[model samples]
Target: MSPTTDRTIDFTTGAPVAGSLDVAWVHGAAGEPNLQVHHYDEHTVILRQSKRVTYEAPFLFLLFGEERALLLDTGATEDAELFPLRATVDRLIDQWLERHPREGYGLVVAHTHGHGDHVAADAQFADRPQTAVVAREPEAVRDFFGFGDGWPTGAVTFDLGGRVLDILGSPGHHAAAITCYDPWTGILFTGDTVYPGRLYAFDFPAFRATLDRLVAFAETNPVTHVLGCHVEMKRRRRRDYPIGATYQPAEHRLELTSADLAAVRDAAHAVAGRKGIHRYDNFVIFNEPGKADQLRLLARGRLHQALAKLTRRN
Candidate 1:
């Protein structure tokens, strides 16, 4: 297959096909599906855990290749009865196989990072045959991704048959954090690192360097959307829903552009030495937040929940 200059929806050679992000996502509404699956294209799928099921409501990605499919982040819940993530994924793979039938198709389970909310349901896929579940620890990630001794630098390529994804070692929000870029659709899966909600920089120096790497990569690549695992911001500028809030009626769009990535990079530079939350239009940076910061944030979330309960009662 010859590489074409044009990047239109050419699935024959694994070119990215565009899909809608305009669906009404499950926002803790009654009778919502445990997991909402959106088919970005014939080979690419986006799944979001329902907030009604868990407050994290993290988004997971399933990208199909010629030989195997890649499932990024098992999501936030462990119970299959409540989350049904593995079941949902199994069904999806079955359906995809129906269209593109093959024997011995495998599944490679990996993550954007190893945070509790992100890697909780990994147990679901542990016993599934022909599936390789990558461990969430920093060392495991380093080994699986072939990061070598250059722990938090450089980039590596992972091939899912013909579909090759560029994986960059991104740390800041979490030490083992990474960012993935798909050339097919030009979507960058950033996980919790550069999402719309609160950006928690547990390690400021590393986080700063990670953003710089991301910004430079986006500049060189044809990135269509910069997507994170969660959407924590509201529709209003510089405003975010309280942490742990189950229902968000006015959540911001999940996709961010390269320009938005640059904005985040610039903001990180501006608050180099900051030790607390710095609010911005698209995201809020919690640079090396202290114990007090976490408690206060938790308190605000509790208040939000209380007010929501009262309003519902009224």
Candidate 2:
């Protein structure tokens, strides 16, 4: 089939349908002003936006439930100008809640990692009593800029009155990275562990393990929609590039399956092995000694490669 030049793309038909989800692109730099929103239902909405970018960062999502809302990964923050994006996101949340008001609404800000781009807005919402900074590790919460209160790891469920969100600890991209799963919508709010493009890895071995766990989870759970933290296009004119302008909701036709997770794991392992024993040892050191600065460059290289390969393959 010939590719359509029309801006809108539909995931359901895997074609460029004129009428689909209403997605507006807030244009800026290559990765700047990366914001996108998907209104799933009257009570459910998903908003993904970029805060800042040293490199192309993932788009963050806001998942609204009946009683409360959850933010899946906040974007980058390299400069001061980008800080306003947090307020923009907050406004969006407020608007969402205004449309569907509940008695006692709360906000749950979670992260895929401790990266600046993904967790920049933690401090912004720290004072809100209804808001809680949830993560897979207690350190992640304590270390967060805005909200420094600690939380627990493993699988924790947050009740949203009508629906329950299960936060699963799937460390690999970052030790504190976790994925939010909504059983009712079949949507998995995957931070960086699984996205449309490449997957980053701070620790290759642990990353692979996390991918394996995700695959296993998919086998038992009905996860039809894998909502990624970031999805940007390389070339706008390319047939595969879905994101036309920045902040636009790029409709991903790719259906994530267990096999996809396995492939990512394999790719990560392959890259880790190619880096040789010394590099592998470095990851172990970083993991054990907590000497992140020691392996900063190496980790960055590995993460870049892992993400690149994942993006290319996906």
Candidate 3:
């Protein structure tokens, strides 16, 4: 099927609406980074954390389900100087629970990887006996907080009453990167594997393999909305950033199609043939004197271009 843009619902009215949410970017204490959250619908929220000075890269969170809230990826660390953000997120989660009381509705916190930006707030949930952490690898679970078991690589499903989340392992961005799909909402929470800005791969080969898996998953799954761990505020071409970003807040709606996947595969092949450093967006990634890294970057770029095209076309 061809890629197309779909209408997103407004969180406040719970009605399908157009246009982006108005976000407020507020700086934390002592010139700490700013954070923003956008609520696309009652069930979906996207939280973004902008790096202090650069504002170049920002962390994102995709929260889903009402009573049994499932957090896709947590924002970057607010440790030391900027600890208030952590409290803010905690309070937000608490408010969500209070607003939609779910008795014995345990919180499920999952991460894209072990990166500090994504998993730093993990300790916050340590004391919450009702909260559980899910990871794709045991080592990641252990590395982050020394708890929980790894999720299987194949398709896995979690039922949240009226909402159902399907977990698919996509390892390209990180060895442990995973994507969550909500069938009812047609939302796909792609960790670092696929986002708005540049794609970073610790191991190019693994990243490409993971992308391939994702392509297959997309082909079989009915994904209408896509959320990434981060969105390039500049690339978004928005006038102002939002304030008080909430959990499971929605931002950019993804356009995934078979043609887009094919383009990504082509890019991966091209990267596999290059040598030395390859420039992508802002930073230059070292290709390890092999074609593997290049291949992965190419695949990432291709997927990105395809999505862009799909968005414009729609």
Candidate 1 collision pairs: 16-184
Candidate 3: list runs displaced more than 4 Å.
1-33, 53-57, 78-86, 134-153, 232-262, 275-314
Q: Which stretches of candidate 1 lie over 4 Å from their true place?
A: 1-16
The TM-score values for the models, in the order shown, are 0.94, 0.63, 0.64
Ranking by lDDT: 1, 2, 3
Task: Give the range of the ten consecutive residues with the poorest summed lDDT in model 1.
Answer: 1-10
Using TM-score as the measure, what is the rank order of every candidate, best first?
1, 3, 2
Model 3 weakest lDDT span, ten residues long? 239-248
The count of residue-pair clashes in candidate 2 stands at 11
Each candidate: what lDDT? 0.89, 0.55, 0.53
Please name the candidate that would achieve the greatest TM-score relative to the true structure: 1
lDDT of 2: 0.55
| lDDT string, candidate 2, 145-188, tens digits | 22223232346666655566666766666777777777666677
